[model samples]
Target: MMYFAPYIDASGLHIPSYTDVRDQLLSDARSIFGQDIYLESDSQDYQWISVVANIVYDSFLTSQAVYNARGPSTAIGSALDIIVKINGIKRLPAAYSTCYVTLTGSVGTIITGGVVADINGYEWTLTTPISIGSSGQATALATCKSPGPITANVGEINKITTPTFGWTAVTNPGTAVTGAYAETDAQLRSRQAISTAQSSQTVLEGVKGAIAAVSGVQRSVVYENDKNVTDANGLPPHSISAVVEGGSDDAIAQAIYNKKGLGCYTNGNVPVQITDLYGVAAVIRFSRPAYVDIDVTINLKQLSGYTTQTTTDIKSAIVAFINSLTIGDSLTLSSLWGAALSANSVPNKPTFSITGVTAARHGQPLGTIDIAIAYNEVTRGNVANIVVNVS
Candidate 1:
């Protein structure tokens, strides 16, 4: 006599299968009506029993889902949204890519609400009311019109869309600070875990947590040098260096100022002035991670079910894995094999066998050796640079 019931034990919630539910319902029917009663598959009584069993199974599934939603790690969608509120954090929305473009034109020419286009045809809106300097040039921050991971490399944004008088040309001198899509559930969950360290007794951990909590901040690493002299990494004594990606400069500076220990010196490339409640101003500094472009070459021997799409997927996967690496994380050539193979979602059968893998810095000769990333540098990979040789 099998009984169908959901139960909670040390292993957590467990629900019986639909087959068990159906069998139990039939058993109950026979116990009430004699065992000799007709309950064939086509019988009205059997159909009614199956209906009740299905409804009970559905209710059990719903109950199980609700139970799992109570924990942040297993929650998803709206459930995850509600759970993260307990940590005083919300999902980071998509952001626009930004770049500094130098406008070369007549001096004192004011361009308000000017627009420019990248070589890829993406439109970027310049900061308003920019007056050309006496050197016949003005540098202004331009934000992409469309949000999310838009990129414009140096010399790419050269088309002036809003053609103001004396505005002869436009171009970005450096790579755009790429934007991001809406934070995924996994990303949010990880951030929530880091945010818990905000109240840590260790000041360094607390400072790191506070910076991680800043809105629009994608990734951050904190390094501290507590000795009486400068350390090997060039950090000043009793100083901290934060290598951060994303977020506004002012917001990151404020977060660091609020949580860092008193008398601690900060070291980095970007500096912002923060005014304390006492009306005293102090300079806080942090580094924006420098990006290193990596080129990869993958040779593959095609297996069953391999297609042109598989090659594309393999390239995309390799690029994604490279870009997801944190600052200062080394790029191991062996790891790329797994990244390339992950493109095959099917179990047991693989789509391709990687014959060889090689990588190098952009414009450098590809090799099998691991690429060393410096403390303030992050590796970036473009699908265009990932060459997949498929047979």
Candidate 2:
């Protein structure tokens, strides 16, 4: 079964499923790994924290009565000693992150306390301070970040119990350095290039394997990481070195997600082809990037059809047919239907036959086209785009 799926509801785009949770975890993983936090394989770390704060006037007066001849009993009533007013009291429930101050105050000082705490959970106490006869300032307490060991990187994704494919280690072939092959700057560049290629191969293979495992979809490659020797012919590095699981290692991955409509994703990497609808099937490709080209092929076939439609006039007929399916077209077609002469019909269809998906640029919203159209196709199906604005 799929781990989770993101679904929308009436409560203002509620991510009413576990996908939000898992995706959040994935986000945390990226946050932890994409930094300099060195991590040892198969190890875990733990930390406990404490935070507290309070507000008071004439704290010096609260000091031990024993300091002066005025014992604890003498503190009770000493001519009302300048008449101090008790400040407001703000109670904290165990430990929560966000807080508000009724009065401007220093959380770092005056108000104070602490308790053992965890990142996701903790204990904290807050204080409220008041003015003392124009001598005191009204204030509240707030917390700040404390620098400590926070960076964490888990093993690479899909690295389950020694998965089949992954990045492989390599050493420069030149004799200059232990792993260095040659002294020339060209050689150094060559060494780095080959190492990079090897790593890309490992990751590409892993991704292909993953897509291959998914049913009803095919995988193909549009481009592969490549390495070329300048001024001479040399065998590229045999092993893959590093593939940017997140970014920076290579051309960042590009993808676009449309939650309001059918989801489409496009990445140079493709999935394994799925041939069986009744039984499990997949599509996959093996590619080597040390060269210019890698062959990729992906296709999703209808094992069974859904509805039936045959029309003499493509527009009216297809519209009627698509109007028959369960979909909304707040989106316009990706392109105006190019009237293909022959009309056709597909029957016994599954819920959605995802023909293809292109991944969004990993980090940047390269572009967006909002389409406001609904689509059903007999000759050519409807497509959507994130245009200037659907409105």
Candidate 3:
């Protein structure tokens, strides 16, 4: 009675439920044997025939399911692992954001490699030893030791701890961005299908596709200066610029090396040079995405419907909404307001404001409190930093 399979319809173009398979077999048996032999009596022979029909119907349903499962768009694609294996694409893994941090201490102080620092208990480790001089500086860039996107916030982790000697302060000048989880099945399928379709030759889009397929790469944009005109950015003519988020520079560079046209150039601030199997070097230039902290404040009046857990739920909703935004994506004030208002415990028309928009810059938060975001930047919001008030 519980059917979970589809069969071809009479039209041949449509697939419909196989719910009547058992009944159809029963009907055929009745028509051929006549009801006088089976339907006229509640006989054991009739029961056996019915049982056999049910078993045959179940087999047909299983066959239908087996047929449907072969398609990538169906639910069984992931279950069977056919989506990746068939297309030669694998799921990207999660990655952490890396950035530079400025460490400050006494004028004569020194900080060594392996020294650990933290913000919100998230650790950033110094990759090299640094000494403080007249400037009271030790190191300028610190890499994140954490392995997830949770430490991707810029300008948030400033406190220095577990220093070598006399190290006083720590700060990140640039936003620590580009942490992301592995691509989902939907995302992988989109990239896999496109790449597979273009398998014959490597093109510009193919280069982008290959980069996107790299594990931990969340998003990417490719720009070309094919005319050889040096644009305002001083990029040489025939150069390509890739702006990407969430992946290792080496992996991205290798992907570019595999797919880009020969003699085409790559340009950017940081360059990763990779050698191919033939020992040819390819240099790919790119910049990691910058993170902008979105600080929101909600004002609400406690009503009969309000519960103690409402604030927590609202904060969670805000964090979830912020996390949903991707690189080069902009969020309007209205959308953010709606996200806060959509919380289960928040009443209608809850008073709110975009208290501020801070660009997690190296030295300070740049820009006014505007809702607009730059193309190379993404947004982040922390529940602990969110301000929620209920009167």
Using TM-score as the measure, which candidate wins? Answer: 1
Model 1, span 152-250: residue lDDT tens: 778989999998998899999999988866888988888888888899999999888898899878878999999999888778899999999988899
Worst 10 residues of 1 by lDDT: 1-10
Q: Would you estimate the TM-scores of all the predictions?
A: 0.79, 0.14, 0.58
Q: Any idea what lDDT model 3 has?
A: 0.64
Candidate 1 lands at a TM-score of 0.79
Regions of candidate 1 where Cα sits further than 4 Å from its true position: 1-4, 17-61, 102-147, 158-170
RMSD of each: 4.5, 34.9, 8.7
The lDDT-based order of candidates, best leading, equals 1, 3, 2
Each candidate's lDDT (Cα)?
0.90, 0.24, 0.64
Model 2: per-residue lDDT, tens digit, 1-391? Answer: 2323333356322222233343344445558776454333333421100000011112322343323323221323332121111111111112112222222223222322311122222222234322212322232232212221111111111111111122111111211100111122222222223323322445444443332222211111222324433212121322121111111111122111100012212222323343345675433222212111101111223234322222223333323223222212232222222121122243333322324212121223432343222221111111111111100
- Point out the worst 10-residue segment of candidate 3 by lDDT: 353-362
- Local lDDT at 36 for model 3: 61
